[model samples]
Target: MNIKLWIDKGFEILLDYGPKLIMAFLIWVIGNFVIKLITKGLKSAMKKAKYDISLSKFLSDLLNWSLKILLIIVVLSTVGIETTSFAAILAAAGLAIGLALQGSLGNFAGGVLIMIFKPFKVDDLIEAQGELGIVKEISIFTTKLRGLSNKEIIIPNGSLSNGNIINYNTEGTRRVDLTFGVSYDSDIKETKSILMSVLINHPLVLNDPEPTVNVSELADSSVNFAVRPWCKADDYWTVYFDITENTKIALDKADIEIPYPHQVEIHKQN
Candidate 1:
């Protein structure tokens, strides 16, 4: 009699909740598939719109997570949970998490601002916070930099957006300023001419602006000539290094002495 009674009670319980269980399971399976399809369609649209890579990925992730969370709530409600109470609990949890992750939120906001304003773009040589490098990638939390030394540097977007960024690639052309010192005895006119010859012979130097060579300063031991040469931004370094070497060689062959600080010593006659 006891076994028959227990079996009857079990059957009654199954009859009461079996449909709800099946419904919840169906919702889970079908909701997940729909979410995948929606995310795929959104990605395809983003690609067609030519959205930036970072922004497109961020939005897609946000939508995916949001949909998944909603799907969970719907599945729970299908299983006979009170959805109003569940939603209240979710709101409270979201507030707590938001407060806890304030810094990350700030970084996220900064990333958004960076993407919208576009202060710097990929491959641009920028200097900020004493780090000089080319912009590699802009992520949701950080900006990547490929340092001139071939090292990778990661800077948080929060500070990067607020800080001063010196972009060297803004202009198509840049002027290379070089200071060369000659001994006071060296003829100023001849020295200037020698420098001009170096600039004129270099193919990278632009002729439109006309390179300026002038005596900028007179030190106690040397006369400093300011050599300003204009070149395309891309050829700046090549022209800089080449002109420096060629100037030295030309000055040496022309018998012009490049001046350096010298300490003169004499034996004191006591």
Candidate 2:
């Protein structure tokens, strides 16, 4: 009610809280600057270490967020705020969310592991979860794959890491497996010789293993020969197509009878 009383009250308030406010503001500013410096250092280190782009970005973001949250808590504590209550609430909320999103969090953790471990990379042909394709991108939750048929597949990171992952392109060489059938009466040695001629003439097929063309099995209808060849990974499909096309022609030229499924009829049945 009195101007004198109001002025005195204002002075008292400033004396009590001004120092605390200044200190809190200073702490926040210093904390934010420190956070920036640390994040920058992290980015530089990651870059120098030649980390993957997706992993580096995710780590940088994660570090910045963690620093910011820590800065907030430190600033609040400086201002004489009780941070324990907030911390308790945060812990409870985190626990509740973690419980609800257990699978998602597992995937996120799996993604981090995948990024760190470097099982497969973009453009690599990988087989996982019964799906075979070229990896397009690796994200925090899922990995994108471009199938051989050009279909896009999104697979969960958890499943990808937890299950078996076959990286076909990791190595430089691959084996081409082919099976050909011939009539039981056909000359086995001649059939093998013809197939071996086909393999030896193919430019893409490697000769280190000597190109196995041996009698594999004898089915009820036909005898099977296993034709195995080693070649460059990139030439696998090419060699496969060429061998399939050439084998048929070579066998036909050699007059090897490839029998079809047929049944004999008996007139005595009548």
Q: Give the top-scoring candidate (TM-score).
A: 2
Q: Candidate 1 residues 1-270, lDDT tens each?
A: 999999999999889878999999999999999999999998898788655687788889999999999999998888888899878988999999999999888888888788778788888888997899989999888899999788999988888888999988888788999999999889989999999999999999999889999999998888999999999877878999999999999999999999877799999999
List ranges where model 1 is wrong by over 4 Å: 1-54, 67-81
CA RMSD of all predictions: 4.1, 2.1
Pairs with backbone N, CA or C atoms under 3 Å apart (clashes), candidate 1: none
Kindly report which residue stretches of model 2 are placed more than 4 angstroms away from their true locations once superposed: 48-52
Query: Against the hidden true structure, what lDDT does model 2 obtain?
Result: 0.90
- For candidate 2, lDDT tens digit of each residue in 1-270? 699999999999899888989998998888888889998999999898767677688889989997898888888888889999998998899899999999998898888888778899888889999999989988888999999899999999988899999998888788898999999989999999999999999999998867898899989889999999889877888999999999999989989998887888878754
lDDT of candidate 1? 0.90
| 115 Cα displacement, candidate 1 (Å) | 1.9
